[model samples]
Target: MEPMDKDRRVPDRYEPGEGCLTTAVRLPVRIVVLVLVVPVRLVWDALAALGRAAHRTVLRPLGGGLAWLWRTLVVLPVAWTWRTLVVAPLGWLWRTLVVAPLGWLWRTLAVAPAVWLWRYVLTPVGRGIAWLVRGLGVALVWLGKALFVWPWVALWRYVLAPVGRGIGAVVAWLVRYLVVVPARWLYAHVLTPLGRGIAWLVRGLGTVLATLVRWIVVVPLVALWRHVLVPSGRVLAVVVTVVVREVGAAFGHCWRVAGIISRAVGRFLGTVLRWLFVEPVRWVYRTVLTPLGHGIRDGIWRPVRQALRTARETVRQTRRELRRALFGAPREPQPAAAVPPRREPGAPGTRTLGSSTTALTKD
Candidate 1:
């Protein structure tokens, strides 16, 4: 790895081969890609800037206002309605009607009956049935052993087993002499060396074919890839890199210029809008409407409001008098005693250079 790294340390990145053909191709390809990529990069940068401006100036505030309006108009109201009309009523109904009745019914009908049946009836019946089943299982097992299992066991152990063993020995002897011995002889004496000879011939032919293919096809292709295509690719890559760098630089310059022009235009538009609409509205609001609204609020609206308030107070006083006359004066409210607020169990003061921070040592 260290040797390979040393060898590759000063490797050429692009333009590895400097030749006439590469030079010719590089010039034209750079010129074309630059021309094409310049306009594309400029347009892309402009559009991207415009998109950012629109998102920042127009879409962002609009989206925030829409979200706020949706929350206020739709989401909050729907949530309140669901909580008030659906969830509250459902919760109340589940508690008052479903839970109470279902709980009572379960306790009265299901629980008591199931418990009684399991304890008083099912337990005794199950035990009796289990005891009977266990006795029958034992008896059946012994009877089956005497009638079926013993006969089969005796027949196999005493009679059929010996016969089967003797027959198996005879068959083994016949198979060894008749089939296995001849097949082994044929494989060892005849087939093995023949297979070896065939394999050797195949290997020799394979070697020749492999050599021919390597020299005819693989070597040429490898040489073409390594010597011709790689150098050409490197030259093309260098041209592409240069073109891209130029285009990127051009895009940076163009984007800066576009932003400057955009800001200038925006300022011009802002000035025009201020003169045409904003100034008149601001002047009118300050000069005319402010005084008029203040006059209306003070002169007429306040007087009417004051009159209504006086009437309300008078009515309230009369009603209070009538209540006092009927119910004999109400008892006065007593004042509450002030109590100190709770103190949490922690150090009250902050620690400084001279103080210890532990709760037990507060100094």
Candidate 2:
């Protein structure tokens, strides 16, 4: 047997037959597995490569091309056919044949006639109806006015006036008999005496007050103002008047001197300007400008005025001719109907007629 140390030590080299029998056996299996797996993997990889090649070279391009073909040939044509044959024609036909004719017919046959009828016939008829209604309203207003006035007239003429006169006469008689007699008696006896007594008392009191005011207040005030204040006011007024007069004299002398200087300067300036500028300008205007203006007026403005007058006369004559031609000549005025003469109230003929009518009615 080997030593224990040998048993504990790990061996560096393994023997093929002693300890690697299972590895050798597994090696065959591994080789077999490698063989099978490599072939299968190779087949799978080849198949995948073939599929990718087919997709890239054939299928993808075929699908894209087919899609493009379908889009170009089928989709575009179908869309074009639908739009051109169906949509466009149907829309155009609907608009042109149906909608246009219907619109035209509605406008010409229905709408235009309706507008005409409303404008010409219905509008005039409506205006006439409104006018008639207004006239009826006016007539009704007049009837209402008559109805409103009739009762007042009847009441005044038949009932109220007569009753009011009778009442007034009764009231007058009562007032005269009862109130007036008593009032006159009171005035004559009591009121007159009382009024006289009151007047006498008032006059006496007024006289006493006037005398007292005159003696106590008014006379003293008058005396004080006359004796003291009036003299002082007169002295002050005299002083003020003297001062005002002196100042006014000085101002007037200064004003006169200033006026004389201003007038002299103004006269000198006026003489210089008139001789230098004003007289020349005035001469030019009178000689050259006035003659030119007169020549223009005679040559241009006078002719224009004459033409305008002739045109106005022609227009007036044309207007008169048109008026005479369109409307016939004016008719002569007819004499007015003769007015009936008014009969005097007590005329013999009027009395006879009235009496004969009365007799006829009575018979």
Candidate 3:
């Protein structure tokens, strides 16, 4: 070999130039960013500007002019015409033609006649009628009292008192003979024996029930608890105790041995996994999967996500613009100033004609 080619420091494989690789990578990235990002940014800015211009120029002025025209042409004229032509004239005519004349006529024709009739004819006639009624009531009461007392006194003295005494004596004799003596005899002979026999039967039944309970239910339960259940429980407890003690001793002996074996096995398994599974997985993730994931995220997912965001923003802007073009931007309603209530003249606590008429009728 030649002297220059025999140098061990030099490699025989072709090595790529750093400048060429950098240029190749950077030019395409710059061109792609200019082509995609710049035009999208420009379009977004232009749409925003157009939306702002339309709102300020066309929609605002039209809304204001329409509001002004409505107030001037419809609202004001209607209010003024209703008040001047209808409400005020009708109220004045009602007061002048209907209310005043009716009030005067009522006072003159109805009130005067009523007062005069009450003072002259009605008062005298009522007094006379009252006197007549009082005389008639007094006569009736006197007649009723006389009629009631005479008959009652006569009947009591002659008929009722003697008859009632004889009847009462007979009733007493009947009750003493028929009811009292029979009740006493029956209670003493029949009811008392029946009650005694019932009490004896009840005592005997209770004693038998007690004996049956002791022999059948209570004795069996006591024998089972004393003889069978106690012995079985004791044997079960002894067996369980022996089993627990043997198990505990065996577990104690095996615990350290098991722990040692498990630790050795775990260490061996961990080393083998690290060499066979863990280390290979780590290398693959670091070298292949991580780079691939980064490439997919940065190159494909990032652009798709950015494009979706742009589309969403554009759709929102278009919808807003369309709504503005059709219905105009919504105006926030201003809070109305609170108006103090207007009190009408002579309205508060003032009675109408109908109420006055009701008062007269009541009186």
Measured by TM-score, the strongest candidate is: 1
Which tens-of-lDDT digit does each residue in 1-363 have in candidate 2?
112343244423334554343344434544444444444444544466568789889999999999999999999999999998999999999999999999999999999999999999999999999999999999999998789988888889999899999999999999999999999999999999999999999999999999999999999999999998999999888666655644454344334433344445546766997999999999999999999999999999999999999999999999999999999778999999997566546543333443445434553
For model 3, the local distance difference test gives 0.76
For residue 212, give model 2's deviation from the true position in Å: 2.5
Candidate 3's displacement at residue 38, Å, is: 36
Q: Who wins the lDDT comparison? A: 1
Candidate 1 lDDT over 271-331, as tens digits, reads 9989999999999999999999999999999999999999999999999999999998999
Output the TM-score of candidate 3.
Answer: 0.37
RMSD of 1: 17.3
Worst 10 residues of 1 by lDDT: 1-10
Q: Assess candidate 1 and give its lDDT.
A: 0.80
lDDT leaderboard ranking: 1, 3, 2
lDDT (10s digit) by residue, model 3, range 200-283? 999999999999999999999999999999999998886666556444434433343333444455467669979999999999
Q: List the residue pairs that clash in candidate 3.
A: none
How big is the positional error of residue 214 in model 2, measured in Å on the Cα after superposition?
A: 2.1
Stretch of 10 with least lDDT, candidate 3: 1-10
